[model samples]
Target: MRDAPLEFVTAMAAHGDVTRHDADGEPVYMLHRPDLARHVLKENGAAYTKDRTPDDDMLRPLLGNGLLTSNGAEWAAQRRMCAPAFRPAEVDRFDRVIVEAAEHLVAHWDGGRPVRVDHDLTSLTLTVIVKAMLGTDIGVAGEGFGRAVDAVNRFIGHYVPSDDPDPADTAARYAGFHRARTFLDRVTRVIIAARRAGGAGDDLLGAMLAEGHTMSDADLRDQVLTIIMAGHETTAKSLTWTLYLLDRNPEAARAVHAEIDEVLEGRSPTAADLPRLRRCRQAVQEAMRLYPPVWLISRRGTADDVLDGYDVPAGSLVCVSPWVLHRDPRYWAEPDAYRPERFDPDRAARLLSHQYLPFGGGPRICVGRHFALVEATLVLAVILRGLRMELVAGFPVEPEALVTLRPRHGLMMIPRPR
Candidate 1:
């Protein structure tokens, strides 16, 4: 499972829509059917809890009881408090940051040489999230900030579900994780302290630390770290995969290029322009369908429950995988193909709830769903308008099923002006 986790889970789809196996005495159920996914993630979601589950166990060390790992009333309160910051008005405010950052990265690209799209996008999205969320320039935190995040991701990539206790952490990996955690903790503390001293903030951080808010410094740290990490990492992976997919499919790439040319002419994209960037947006959507950033969603049953006629014992671990569901031949036509048109507005509208959950579903759906789509679409537009990335030949790109689905060795591409 550790050597090839994605492959191991994907192989189960061959058996049936629902598969069960034992891991250290616990029954692990993998749901491949959308209806079943809905049962676990939505309709009967109350029966499952993220708290203390495999996902929370792995992420709690880093995220604490942030919205992603919290449960019940605690999760509800956090979600409500954070909702105002992600409203339409607030997300629109982030467009300029996304485009400007993408444009900045484009300016640095060497058109003639191979560029690491994954690495550059990671840095770009990190910068955007920091500036947009906390109103601070990540640059001030130095290069180690990005390195620390990378180290954390590397350590997390080693995670595998087991009923037994986690194996002893490797010395080098644990050291890297510690440094990353410490650096992020210190940075968030400084930002929060400065903001508190400066009085009210108009950004996400300020709102969370506003007057009368019950969030202590530690609580703020968890929420801030969760946003900074969740906000940037997934979007970066989505863009990287979008570019890689477009590069692999010439017809799709041309469609995106033509759409961008017609829509923007020579100007940069804004939030208003998002509605018309159809093909570019669809490309991003399809890429996520093929390689969802959050490939696995883990929860444990809080009580005995029945799903799809199967008796789910209390304490059973249930997993809903977008990776497996997205490619189900039962729902998607030519499931393995890079066909962005699959996400054409009308066609996409026909998709059932869990059939295409790049951002998940139900009450606990990703709070930043709109923000992520807007950011990815606009960033893709900004890039396609000024440059085209050509995937290096035989680069051997493979998806590493870590905390996010990432190109295992980084995507090497040549940036050519469009």
Candidate 2:
């Protein structure tokens, strides 16, 4: 499971929609059917808690008790506090930030050389989140924050829970983790201090800061870090995979380019144009279906329950994986193929509940879903209209199932100006 998580999960899904396995003497239940997902993520979501899950164990060290790690009333309050800023109208105001960031990346690309676009997109997204949500330019802090996240991702990428571990390797990994954590902590404090002095604005960070009387500086820091990690990292990987999939399927690429050409007509897209950029939207949606950024959603059952006739005992590790669910033949046609039309608005609306959850389902659905889709669509339009990325031959692309599913080797591609 540690070395090849995708294969392991895929094999498990093949056995049955609901399968039970033993992991170090603990029960791990995998649910693949859509109704089962609905049952676990929605109907009985209260009975399941993120506490003690792998995600909680790995991220709580860095994310603290932010939305991702908190439970019960705390989580609800954080969600309510953070909700206003991500409302569709509020997110629409960030469109300029998203477009400008993408335009900056397009202007910087050297058409003559191969670029590691995955890395570049990561930086671009960091800039967007910092400027749009945090209410400040990334400036000097952006580079260090990017490095810190990369180091943290590297550490988490190789992490596997264990009773006994190698002392030397564990020490090395924790050394880097602590270094990253320290840098993140320092930068977060500086941002909070600077933002507080200026008074809170209307962005996500500002929204949180507006309620500062109720939250400690440490609490604010945790939420800020959570937004940074959840906001930027996941969107960056989604864009990277969207481009990779387009490169893999020329027909889809041509369709996307045609739609962009028709929709923009040589002008940069605005938030208003989002609804009209159907193909661009569909392509991103399809790409996520194939390689969701948050591939696995894990929780621990707080009480015993029967899901689809399978008994899930309290203290068991329950899994709802988009990676497995998206490909289930029960919900998708040609599940292995890259077909963007599967998300054509009419067809998309008909998809069964919980069958296509790139942003997840239930009350815990990503608060930034609208923000991410708008950013992804506009940025994708910008890239497809301005340049063409060709995968460098023999550059092996495999999904590394870490905290986020990322291309194992950074996506190496040659850019040709459109």
Candidate 3:
């Protein structure tokens, strides 16, 4: 019973699985055991669904039964319709879009001044996702969307069940959520309308429309909103975290640059160069293990189940946190160290299933995994080729547990000319 909240949860994880009584006094199981987490996420995945808490409801207005939050038949249908859009070939098609965005970001960097790396990464990814997914220019809409995301992150970070009603606070939270949703809704609707008007061309939205599914305005908005939010935030954090790690680990950063230099020789990275950027990909993978974006994944059991000798009732809230599992000593050697060699193809090939769940597992695993990896790798290569970053003195980087793991204070760093 510590006074702090998230620290208590993090400490509880070091031991075996811990169950806490929620606001309703119902037991919510937090599985810190890596093997058990693997069992539930991969081996026994069929027993769980993603609708674990009111968080889904909070996002429902904007996502509107989209694949990310939808369960059962709706999830299946959305997955089927959008699966092709994220296929390896389709994701490769967005390489130029990602490279272009990276170049645009690099062009704005001032080597003379300290820059907030977090903001730059977010803006870059948002621009790339908007162009690649919808074939639309959301440059004007990005500022509002970024603010809304900040508001949403703040809301999720400080979330606690209310024991007594405070009307002003409640109204403000709801207002913030709605404002964020409205911003995304406007962008999504415009993209959908443009696609319908034959402007999407060869982008993902165009492919979705060509599939012959007559989605209503609301449904289309939700799907687009979900993709845009997830597409930008997750990969942006991945790159941000990678940069943080690189600043501290110069040798690892050098290895990555060497790989890129040998592979591309200063040309922009294309899909074919992705495989050649092995060290860069490993660096990103290791960074994710150290600072995963989607740190905690929650689910609710649809039926009673026993996982690793613990009884989980039909309505139990089950959380399998990658933040804990990725660093489990039983699975990783030198768990706290930043070592990209762990993900080397030869090494990773021998790992047990579910040992590394950066993108999750099972049927409901993130459909955007390929997309995120491509975007992260390309951005990493592009940045390293042009500039070098060093951690700023006296600027503390602390992980803030929100819907994703972001820096509490902005990630400030100094960019020196390479």
Candidate 4:
């Protein structure tokens, strides 16, 4: 388990690209080869589905059969129906909302004081997505609501079904998942019904209704919960990592601010301005490369599959660590360094296909990838340009692979006025 980050990386490096081992009797293939990754994620994708039982077991209770966890026909159909909601123009509509959320964070900050970045960015991303993706304002709404979701994410992230636990304790966590999920379900249902009746339908819920494709309440719950949780969580962690990286590397922060100065000239960045904010984009990309928000992408081989002479039996578990691949010493120099320039023009050009799995690969790649990039770009533009975030000295910020590659102890920093 990469939950033990050091052991996981050392193991991956030991085998170079592909390694197969028995895990409590069943075969587990840890693949690092780029072409092989394409085989599993792109070319021979049908042989696999995102149904690795161990992780999805915890997710099923929260996500239902949403796009993130569904397989086969259900997955394909839902992908089509939800495509329009994330189309360029639809996501473009949320530009102002992203900026507003970024600015709102800056406004609340007192400057030069230690800030709990994980909490702040989570609140900002949650608030933005709830408004922009769902057409509802859950602005800094409930500290408890955010805290509850964190508890569920923690339980799911570190949970290993194989490890037997006390039945009483397991039941309590299950109860917690339902408690948080029920609240989210109510919120999603409200948006769904309102949109159906021609009410507050400005986000994806609106777009779905406008298309006349109705989903049963159960399906709707799954979709909304999937979008809200999956949609906001990854981007939030990515943003947190980006800021933390920039804060510690003043040179990278200078380059980021320089790009903002040259491009936006002291104004909030818009979609059109994104292309020119090269350094900002690189900083974010590099951060994701170093600490991908969703650290592990796993699937189950539905049919016997072979890659590079290695046989992967049907029902076997396959895993790809963007965290591992991005840092593979074979491909990346100084695999552990935080240098945003690694993503710059000359360097990015030399990168290979599956060498970067920040958003995963191929057809089943995250549908929200574009929207996430846009939101992250805009938020980075606003904050990285105007603020200087310094990590609280002596605070150890390390990756704790959970539902996301969250900072082990929430990223603590001081966001001083630039």
Best by TM-score: 2
**Model 1 TM-score, all chains together:** 0.96
Q: Tens digit of lDDT per residue, candidate 3, span 65-151?
A: 787789888899888877777899989988999999898888778554788888889988899888887788887878788888878
How does model 3 fare in lDDT? 0.80
Cα lDDT tens digits for candidate 4, 227-319: 888788899899899988887788888888888888988888888887787888788899999989867777889999887787778998887
In order, candidate lDDTs are: 0.86, 0.89, 0.80, 0.80
Clashing pairs in 1: none
Off by over 4 Å in 1: 160-169, 211-213
Q: Who wins the lDDT comparison?
A: 2
Better of 2 and 4 by lDDT: 2
State the lDDT of candidate 1 residue by residue for 1-418, as single tens digits. 5788888888987888778987666779888899998988899899889875667867888888788888999999989888888888899978999999889888888456888888888888888888887888878574667778788888866754454254565666788899899998998788778778887678888778773368877898898889988998899999999999999899999999999999999999999998899998899999999999988888899999887788889988999889999988889989999999988878888998788888887788999888888899998998889788898888989999888899999899998877
lDDT of 2 by residue, 7-84 (tens): 999999988989988887888999988988898889999999999998897789899999989999999999998888
Model 1 lDDT vs. the true structure? Answer: 0.86
List the lowest-lDDT window of 10 residues for candidate 4: 136-145
Off by over 4 Å in 3: 1-6, 17-23, 54-58, 164-170, 211-213
The stretch of ten residues in a row with the least summed lDDT in candidate 3 is: 1-10
